[model samples]
Target: MPEVVQNVSKEGVKYIILGCGRTGYNVAEELAKETEDLIIVDKDEKRVEDLRDQKYNALVRDFSNPGFMDGLPVPEVAFILANDREANLAALKTIKSRYPATYVIARAIDAVSVDLLQQEGADVVLYPQEVVARTAIYHIRKLHSSRLALRLYDLLASWEGTLCIVTHLNPDPDSISSAMALSLIARHASHNKLNCRIVYEGDIGHQENRAFINLLDIKMERLTPQMLEECGYIALVDSSGPGVNNNLPKSTRVNIIIDHHKNNTQPPSAVADFIDIRPGVGATASIMTQYLMELDIPVSKTVATALLYGIRADTRDFKRNVTPQDLNYAAFLLPLTDADLLDKITSPSVSLETIEIIGNAIRNRKINSGYLFSNVGYIRNRDALPQAADMLIHLEGVNTALVYGITDQNIIISARNKDIRLHLGNVMAEAFGSIGEAGGHATMAAAMIPLSYFSMAKDKEGLLTLIIDPILKRFSEIVGLDGEGEE
Candidate 1:
């Protein structure tokens, strides 16, 4: 950082760009559009002459000379981008010592030079190899995404009539936003010949999720038995399979699937015409955002806001299960999103059911050796289970939290863990996969067992009490506690 003065001479040049190589030339070209009060310097006489011919303020001078810039006014900033890394460092030190108020951006030879340049008073260090590597990765991903977008367009073009986009049961922000993006893609690709409808099976009872849908005016329908027969094509997003986390029948024929979950063992049963599931990504909305960019589709403010929030929610604000692609996609959407609407969607008031569920989870929590397990009693909204787990995991001395609740037809469970020694997703899958469907990322996971699995209980209340012990015991034992934490 450089010294901040209240005012400087408007007649003086604002920027001094040393080492007019490719990097420096490109930067100056862009900056020239904003102002002509800038100088481009290079030690090569021929290079400086060529730049001068192109109407640039180019100068040939040795940077090692302490008075090379003797006749010039003190520029506000200097860019020392040269291939000669050592020479760049020398120029940086000279500039900093003489013009202590000027900001200096210096190039580094390698990774090690980065630290040395910063220590030598360079305000910013630029490494050529790191810059090229990052740029190469972004272009490579864009190329791949472009090819995939073309395939998706071709598939949509071939289809006509209704196309149902099914999200996971009790749809969250990720699923809802991904569905919106897919619907937009379908309409654009098919030239509006396709009627895209978003469908889900469970209640949108989560307060934040409800706010997201309403504030964005997203249109969706509840899944019914007739929905399968009515829609000509079916696509699932956020959830990989037909029946894994959604109410779709296991045997239903799915036409398309786009999800980000890691499915190591149980792959989707229905063979689809198109499937893009990347386990490394944090959110399906990120994948959808990539499609929009590569295909050159117009994104509305509402859609961008939804997709941005979706990425943040699923990645825990880019803190969990995130990848480079997720971050890149989120950055692409940032400028297009509506910040005020995103604030409203994320900060919705909690519902009474959710508050009650969290209270029950805290009151009934049992902890032993950093492991905590709680039963939230009977719940109408299964989404509350994960909210409870997320809250309980913050308790003092608790490294893992497991929260379960009984619905009318299923026993839903959600767990969160921060312990380095445990992969919570694998633990949940191994403990409950035999009786129900379960699996997720390293930090978080979920499972759902049908009420029929515990048919011995005569009523819902009894069933809630009946399965608590076995659930705790199985989870504790699998994690090496051997039922020590069970009631």
Candidate 2:
């Protein structure tokens, strides 16, 4: 168990458990150690007696009955663990409808029920069989000698054709490094049976990103529709769901997906045969690092440096949304990584256009209740918008920053937030998702709205108003502001 999980405290919280089956009993027993205010209810007299004998608060009543719940106190947490699907559903509905504020967790018997329970207002739905299978896999991998990696290798070894590893468009350090690490894994796993190729779409225009790719010698091909059709197996790294940010078509059959984004709107199992999406993990490189460690694969200095940089970039040098796994992997990769090469990658020469973009952002910035917005007119290097947004958020009075500019056929928007209460990705999605594809992490997000969405204006100033006005209007609606005019 991780130290973080073990150290979680449930002090002063009340728990109400419905059903006294093996699952419920076990949960109540464990939770009893955390808090004293626990109530266990069961329809069976024998099960109720069992809890009573153990000196636990027990009630003999139908958990699905609204009368039974009406007499009880509104608990902070409620658990429905009935074996019958209908009974569990009834209990879940009752708890949610009666105690709307309570956090309810219900047991699910099958994969189909998981979705149903969630739709019915269960805050969390537990599937024991799936949990057990996952736990078994975890233990089997740990106890056996490179069993998980070997199993993955065996699967790749069976393939007699090409394997394509795809990364998100405008590949970041995490996406690029993760693809390289997966390619390395495939090389070690199947020798030469699987011809693995790394591919991506969009420009690597960021100075640091280009330097990282060049210094590490990470080779990636530009993905095309024809190339995708020729591959036997497709693996997505640091990206989940097709047709989102990746170049892969929605109908493309994927064999594997490894990503750290928790808010993947697509059902992972539907798109890939082998899915490993760990939202708790800060970076996909950390996940790949664990696999390398488990397989005992030799980590070359170049690979180490890339993986370390991936983790650092994703976590913002461990200053933003970080997890224990990221810290552990960073520690593991630190010694093997080339420090001098890392410094070189980090200190790339900035372009004059990027400097001018930042200057324009500063001069044209507008602030509304701690939220700063900037329009850096026509920018060739679209990547500089994000760099400027990140810099603008560091201003003393700013809690959030949005920077946008016109480039080619798209109006690119990059957003950053220092406020923990705001999810910038969701904000971006709400503001411009209908016009374009927009989504990202909590602190950092980006949106690309096509130029066709705006009415073409003849002059520069008219075009600026035509392009930026709608974006500001939508954003202002979301943040509850009455339109802060341009500075």
Candidate 3:
């Protein structure tokens, strides 16, 4: 790569760009799939101002003054792409000192700083000479790939083509939106590319979720034992692995995987040529949003609204697990989301069933070990469990809220917390250790218990007792309770 270096080492001025500034339009395009929190910082005020004008968050102050960024979200991941080796190291050091956990990937001008930057905790050191030369080569290869696709289309006698089976780990607004968006991209970009049918596992159990599918009318093929047999290719979103119920047929290979969750111990990855997993990102919709923008694709009002809802719900409206990509993509999608329609999606009315569930929770709620437990009986809508858990966390005595409800198919449990008492995913996973699948974000989690299975326990009382015991014990552990109640 060093021998192929042609362009001067230019780094860190632009981050999370799908393409270079017109050089090839997609410099290191694969990086965009992996990149989550991308920030471009420069000592030049004009450059920062220019970026700010373009809706990029830019701090004009010099790097020497830490106070300059008191309010701004300091970048945890730093890319030292500057040609000057000295300044590059300074930027890397500054980022490291500020964000200890940040992965600093620096561009070494020569061999001198490569090893030194590696020792200095730079996760990746890119040689400028090599990357610049490959940029042109990358563009030509992309052009050829597209040309080949077009050429192949003319040869296909049948209009009907294969389907890209798109689904996610746990179906949510972001995951579904991305699956739809990606399929749309793949269909439009390739002249004679295969048709795609979006599919997913898990219930679309959120208000925004209902709005996305209903308003957008994005057709998602329902996956069943029979459907999996015919599907030849799979595209996974939100999550990755076999532990998830969305597992494709063993013969059906995965073609692409776009996810935002951190990697975990899951089954062998599906066969995918393009795999983009941004762990630091809050939403995969953000990534797709950028692709549409760059490709000059016109997003419909409903699609925009869905994208906005997807980003907002996934990030909790930029409260947690947010990154520059999320913010930038959100800024781009804001105007596209109808102002009047947003009100409808944002504060959709709750069902009477949900309201009754809340009232029942208030009446039968128990506060013990600084935890709130509302084992609401049978729930018509499983979505109510998450809303119940989220509401219970606001109660004064509650640091953790576990809301469990039995639906016809599964016993759904939702957990919400403020402190690091217990990782909700692990808690729910252990609770359903050998029963059913359960995993999610650190602060929020969802578990499914097959009623047919749970109800078949030795006795009715025993089944209920066994299911609720884990919640009680975990809460007691967090609050230092000695297995006894507050009394």
Which lDDT tens digits does candidate 1 get at residues 326-354?
Answer: 99999999999999999999899998989
C-alpha RMSD of candidate 2 = 13.1
Taken over the whole model, the C-alpha lDDT of each candidate is 0.86, 0.83, 0.64
Judged by lDDT relative to the true structure, which candidate is superior, 1 or 2? 1
User: Which ranges in model 3 have alpha carbons more than 4 Å from their true place?
Assistant: 1-160, 229-232, 242-251, 420-436, 450-452, 455-467, 474-479, 483-487
How high is each candidate's TM-score? 0.81, 0.67, 0.63
Model 3: per-residue Cα lDDT over 1-487, one tens digit each: 0111112144332342211222212333344455423444456656556655554443444444444334445444555565567766666666667667766677787888888788778888887677888998988965764554343233221224655555663477787777767666666655546667777666676665676576667787667766655655556766564344465555556656667777465655555655666678879888778667766667878778777878888898899799987998899999887877777767777778778887776666777766677778776767777887888888887777778777656667788877685676776676564666577767887777676755545454345556667645754564465755741
Pick by TM-score: 1 or 3, better one: 1
Alpha-carbon deviation at 153 in model 1, angstroms: 1.2
- Give candidate 3's TM-score: 0.63
- Determine which window of 10 residues in candidate 2 has minimal summed lDDT: 1-10
lDDT for predicted candidate 3 compared with the true structure:
0.64
